[model samples]
Target: MATQHPNALTRALAELPGPLPAFGVIHIAIPHTSRFTVVGNHLAQHAELSLVAIGIGVHIQSLPVGSLVGIKALTARFAEGEMRIAAALRELEAHGYLRRAHVRLANGRMATRTVFCNQPGALERAGRVVVAPKVPPAVPEEAPAVPEEPPAPPPAPEPDPVPESHPPVRVPPRTAPKPPRRPLPQPRELTPELRRTASAILADLRSHAKELVLSEDDIEELIPGVAAWLEREVRPDAIRHALTADLPKPPKYPAKIVRHRLTVLLPPPLPGAEELAPAAHRPLVIPLQNCDGCDRAFRSREPGRCRGCRDLAAAA
Candidate 1:
């Protein structure tokens, strides 16, 4: 069986509507140099925009204004939170790359218009294009003129009295005695040395942890504890060991940790007389002067030595 061709079998074909005119394509021109300009401009630093901010700016330039789906689209595309998108938009506006104006429409409608610019000067140009409503001139009313009064005549001159001369007395001028200058207080004997030690320790810790950032004030405050520990005959290595022990990985608040350890590990004060007194009659003893070695107040029969110094000397 020979099948007849469908085109040969058809008697007539209805004409199809002429192909609809192809919709016009929208082409947006973005300069490649914009990337260099955006990063090199002072606005980038002033606005403190991260890579997220740059992404948001590029999208804003490409997308249509007042797009309700922009937030969701940006979130999906950039893998960022809505708040971050909003913040980036704010940064762009702050740096003059974006502007929003509330405009009243011809039909008494209000709309928010978003304007994006590649350069800051475009914002000024956009602003100038908006013509302000002309204000009518006000005709000021004339004030009544005030009459001027004539000047009064000068008074008559009085007669001068005869001059009386007296011998000028020679008096010595009193002079104030200059105040004595008080000597400036000298720096503490241990402060400079302890400060140097503190600086070295802080530098070492920063190198090791990279997170331990201490200011000069923090170092100054911490040095006193270090000095106290040194005065108590504790070795610097011991202090370092104590600080570094049991530290968390990438320790948080290193200054706080150091301070806590320094305070908690401080040696207890030397035993008082109450501890040395006999069980039968415990008498109260008052410390007379500070120890020469550690500057700790203690009751001692000797002139210069505290009990700790005496013990150290005996051990030596």
Candidate 2:
């Protein structure tokens, strides 16, 4: 019989490792009545997923698991840093959209495999039974059936002697010890002046850019750098100018952009009194002199005589 050829779509589908469920789209459920409420619920609890999570999620959804994109690549693609990418991934894992497992390979090597599931509970169900790579068991050639002998006698159990008891040995039941409570981290104390300066800088940035949005944590992190800038006598307007200069149209990731600009434009620290001491102690440069006779100006070690004039005077 002539073999029937598979169509293009069928061939493409067959080449895929497994079925593609949603084709290329991820559906986010939006409640008809309480849309904001549902979004706010996620934002409040999963703060790490707030800022760049949607972008990262969309990017990951487009690619297959075990694709060769690294953290650096993701950072470049999202225009954020490795920390942000890592935090977003952690958030995804925490929310059960992503999972990682070390699976044994056919070559006796172990490799980490990442599994992305559209449904949250899929990973949990998958965890119940591990599906490892199947290696075919080596089959030996079938041997001729052997005739078995059926007449073996069973051994009888021995009778127990009376047990001698000392006092009933008291053994305490083992119990797991309670975990020690971790000490709470102390809140970082900022001077009122530093706080005011940082607030002023942040306020100026907001006023200038309007697009820059920084959270309380972001503000706290940026305060020390702004404080240092203030210490160097950098003006507030300069800070604002530095932040908003050359901004992209409809700026994306404003916090990162602002932070990057602020870090890059921070004025170098002023030299200390010790650094100025050598220059201060150096001998002063004497003013240049013109010889009365020659009218030629020269640097005068001794006042008012050029070398020629001095030589002539010495000759006389």
Candidate 3:
């Protein structure tokens, strides 16, 4: 018998099937004309950097200068939580992709300054960049009696050029303070029974979904909506499923999500007994009876002979 064909080599030589999903990712890349960030394979293919870290670095680079990459800002924007984001930042810092320093401002408040280094290896060898030159102190003027050599003009020490990879660091200007988040409003006028049942269900939601752990205040705000579902005879388990199912990865606004689900997925109230249509009356089924003269079976409302048997008897 002939030897089996080489499957791997054949598949490799053949054109990739259009309809089929082949192994590995295929790129039909369009060259970017603008708004593009250049990333080196050193960073892109770092052996030690985690996927999260690589993503964060790229995101930071693509952002406009002075765009906030703080923990809170990142958590709100990306699916990764604060802890993971923080860890990724630290990873980038350790790998020389980023540097963070705490500096106290003129207003006596501390601020974190983050610097993105495109090529960390070059920056390390070149050392820190100097923004301004250090001027030598002027020589003290002596009296005419001891007029020795005239003092020379101070030599201006030229500052070192910024490393090829490290750009000039610029701090963002101070702006007006932001307003605090508005408080959530709790529902009122719900009956004790309904409120209790709905609250219980909401409170227990954390068990099924770790990300859905809502604050007590948020639960209070969302009670009315869940109670509405309960009024419509929706089961507690079903209510749980609707609120938690297919939720976005690492849901940031748990309260808003719960409130939205409760409002949108609420079932219509069941109709009352009187509102339901009465059962339709079915026609009575006749029983099979034997004919008196012919002993033939026939269907009749009451026990009687078949029509043929009755006609024969009449004739006789």
Give per-model CA RMSD. 33.9, 26.1, 25.4
Clashing pairs in 3: none
Model 3 C-alpha RMSD to native: 25.4
Q: Which stretch of 10 consecutive residues in model 2 shows the poorest summed lDDT? A: 30-39
Q: Please give, for residues 87-138, the per-residue lDDT of candidate 1 as tens digits.
A: 8887788877766656554433477766555556643664432111111122
Q: What is the C-alpha lDDT of each candidate?
A: 0.56, 0.57, 0.70
Tens-digit lDDT track of model 3 for 113-154: 777776787667867522111212322223233233322223
The predicted structure with the larger lDDT, 1 or 3, is 3
Please list the residue runs of candidate 2 whose C-alpha ends up more than 4 Å from where it truly belongs after superposition.
1-190, 272-281, 284-316
lDDT for 4 in candidate 1 is 72
Model 2 C-alpha lDDT per residue in residues 80-195, reported as the tens digit of each score: 88998888888777886656656554433477766544445543664432222111222222323324322122223333222221212211222434334323222245578867
Instruction: Return the lDDT, model 3, position 143.
Output: 20
Indicate which candidate wins on TM-score: 3
lDDT comparison, 1 vs 2, better candidate: 2
Indicate which candidate wins on lDDT. Answer: 3
Model 3 segments beyond 4 Å from truth? 1-23, 102-111, 129-316
